[model samples]
Target: MQDQFDLDVFGNYLFIFCGGSRNKYNALHWDGDGFILLYKRLKSGVIQVIQWPRSREDLRMVSQQELRWLLEGLSIEQPKAIKKAKTGYFH
Candidate 1:
């Protein structure tokens, strides 16, 4: 994962979904000392399809609510929800 993603820093959570069926997921995190891997599998019901970004240019940060939606088998894009404020917009 570090090599594929070109990760040079620690303290970031990387979420990985299995292809086909999509019933399992792996969460990889760097805990400053070593890597920790967490895996989860649904007993029933497959995880909803997510429109994942295909390229580096499409990558963006997601909020806690968005992560929750994803785990609950929902899209992260909440069209009706208030959007997060951009950095340095007030200044």
Candidate 2:
């Protein structure tokens, strides 16, 4: 899968990543030739790899749309149910 999407930066090919809150099987759209859309449908497990303690955490399943943010060095920020304690509490 990586072999196909990973393209050179000489304009010869382009690789686009799109992540979203949808299922893993969501087909991503790429405006290119022979650019295959890769997706995986988990039968009985989680689609994204995360920790067990976070397993119960409300995770927004990423799709092709969200994958864009990931490739750009950004991260998916799902609205967490349990908010973390405020920083500078002692201040």
**Top lDDT hit:** 1
Report the C-alpha lDDT of model 2 over 13-85, residue by residue, as the tens digit. Answer: 3333333532344344445555456555444433342321222243334555456644433333445434456
| lDDT (C-alpha, whole model) for all candidates | 0.67, 0.41
Give the residue spans of candidate 1 off by over 4 A: 9-11, 79-91
TM-score for all models, in order of appearance: 0.66, 0.24
Q: Residue-wise lDDT of candidate 1 within 13-74, one digit each (tens)?
A: 66555557677776767788987887778777766656555555656677888877767666
In candidate 1, how many Å is residue 86 off?
6.6
How far is 21's C-alpha from truth in model 1 (Å)? 1.2
Over all chains combined, what TM-score does candidate 1 have? 0.66
Residue 18, candidate 1: Cα error in Å is: 3.1
Model 1, clash count? 0
Q: Candidate 2: how many backbone clashes?
A: 11
